[model samples]
Target: MQHPAVPELAHTHTRPIHWVATATAIAGVVALSSLLQPKPATAAQSATPDAKPAPTTAPSTADVDFPLDCGPEQALVVKKATGDLDGDGTPETVAVVHCDAPMGTPPDGVYVLTHNPGHTHARVVATLIDPKARNTVTGLTVTDGAVLATLLGYSTADVPSCCPDVKDSARWQWKDNTFVRSTPAGARSI
Candidate 1:
C-alpha cells in the first residue's frame, strides 16, 4: 500500500502550466502587432491638387518701326496680310521678301510689319540668323491684337561650329492711347 506522503508528493509534482500560458501570451502579442501594422495608401488619399497653370504676359509695344533696309533686294514686302496682326478691326498685312543670297546666307530675309496709328511707327517682326545659317524664328502669329514673333536660332547639331544658338520672339501691343501693339483684331485705332 502507498503511504500518505506518496500521494501528497504526486499532487505537488503537477505538470508545469507556465509554458502554455507563455505560448498563449506570445500568440496574442503577434495578433495585436499584425492588426496595428500600417496599410497601403488609397488613390483618394494620395491625390492632391497643387499644380496650376502659368499666367500669360502681354507683349510690349513701346517702340514700333520697320527697318529702313526692307525691300525685295534687302527686305521682304508684306506678302499675305490677313486677320488683324495689330488687333485693329481692319485686316493685317503680310509680305514675303526674297533674298539674293542662298538659304544658309546671313542676308536680311522674310518679315511681317504692323503699322502703328498716326503712321508715326511700324512694328517690324522678322526671321533672321547670325553668320551661321539656321532657322531662328519658329512661331510667328498674331493673337488678341498683339503680334507674337518668335526667333529660334541655330542648334548645336545644326551648326557644327561653336556659335551660340539664339532663340527669341517678340510681341507687339498698343498702349498709352497709341497703337503700341495691343489691339484686338479687325479694329483700327491710331
Candidate 2:
C-alpha cells in the first residue's frame, strides 16, 4: 500500500520538547539564585581594618539617661518633646509613635503623653498619625503653651522613609483639656 502524503520525520515530538524547555528554565533559575546568594564572611575578614582604637575615657553621656524608661517591649518612647504639654505644671511628653509600624502602612507620628502624679502610668492626649505624608518629627518646640511639631514629609509616596523633601511645621495647642490643631499644615500640593 502507498504511504500517506507526509513522512514519519515530519511529525513533531511536542510533549518531550516542552518538558525539556521547562526543565532547562528551572535549572537556569536555580543556577542564577546560587550566584546571587550573599556570601558568608570568613574569619580573616572579621577584623575591621579601618577600626579606631577603643576610647580611653568614658563617654560624655554616661551619666545621662537618654531614650529614657521602658524596656524593649515598650512600643512608644518620647523621641522629641518633654515639657508642660497640658499646662499642668508636671512635665508632659511628646514622641513619634506609629501604631501601624509592625502591621499596616507606616504611620510614624507625633504623640503627646500627659503625666499623672497620682499613678505611674501616662495617658496619651494627642496622636497625629500622618500616614500618607510625613516620615517622622524632626523637631518639636513648645512655645508659649503651644506645641510646634516640625515634620519631614516625603517628596513622593514611593520614596523611602528617611528621605523627605517637604517640611510641615504644624502647631497644636492644649485647650479645654484637649489637644487642638491651632494651624493646619497638611500635605503639600502634589
Candidate 3:
C-alpha cells in the first residue's frame, strides 16, 4: 500500500493508542499487589525462643491509706465502717476521722475519710470542715442505697474553693482499702 509522504501523517499514524490504558492497568496491578501482601512480623513477636521473658513489677499500694493531714493538722479519729457509696455490689469501709486542730490553725477540727480503689492501699479521701460555715459538709447520711456526706467547710489547703457547686459535691468513696474524695463523676483516689 502506498503511504502519504507528509511528515505529520507518517509520524502521527505510527504510534499505538493503547499506551495510556496499558500504563493505567500496570499501575492498578502494582497497587493491588502491594495491598494483598502480608505485613512483616514485629520484632518482639519474632524474637528468638531463648530470649528471657520481661520481668513484671508488683502493683503499687499507694491508695491503701488516706491523707492524715488535710492541710497541716493531724488525723484525730479514723472510724472504720463499710457501705456501698456507688450502690455497687462491693461495699467499702468509710473512715470517719476527726482532726484535732484546724488544718492550718489551732483546734484543728473534724474531717471525713473515704477510699480510693485505684490505689493499692486505703487513704483519707476527703475532709469536711465545720458545717456552720458556707460550703461545708453538714453530715454523713447513708440511705437505702445512697450514701450522702455533707460538706461542712472548705479547706484552704486541701480542697478547691469552688467545690460542692451544682455539678461537683465534696464526697468520698471506699475503694481498695482507703477513703477517697467523692465527686458526682465518681470517687477520686487520694
The TM-score between candidate 3 and the true structure equals 0.29
Estimate candidate 3's alpha-carbon lDDT, on a 0 to 1 scale.
Answer: 0.45
| Candidate 2 wrong stretches, greater than 4 Å | 1-78, 98-107, 130-134, 160-162, 184-190
Per-structure clash totals for the candidates:
35, 0, 35
lDDT of 3 at 8: 56
lDDT per model vs. reference: 0.44, 0.58, 0.45
- Better lDDT candidate (1, 2): 2
Model 2: weakest 10-residue lDDT segment is: 57-66
Candidate 3 Cα outliers beyond 4 Å, as residue runs: 1-64, 70-73, 78-81, 102-136, 154-190
lDDT tens per residue, model 1, 1-190:
7566544654455466866777899999999999998877777444358633221222222233334343444433323333454344454443333334434433223345444444444555543222124433344565665555454444456553334365555555545533443323532211
- For model 3, residues 72-136, the per-residue Cα lDDT tens digits are 64445433334555444444444445446544322222333334344444444444434233333
TM-score-sorted candidate list, best first: 2, 1, 3
TM-score of each: 0.33, 0.45, 0.29
**Model 1 misplacement above 4 A:** 1-81, 85-87, 94-98, 107-135, 153-164, 177-190
Top model number, lDDT: 2
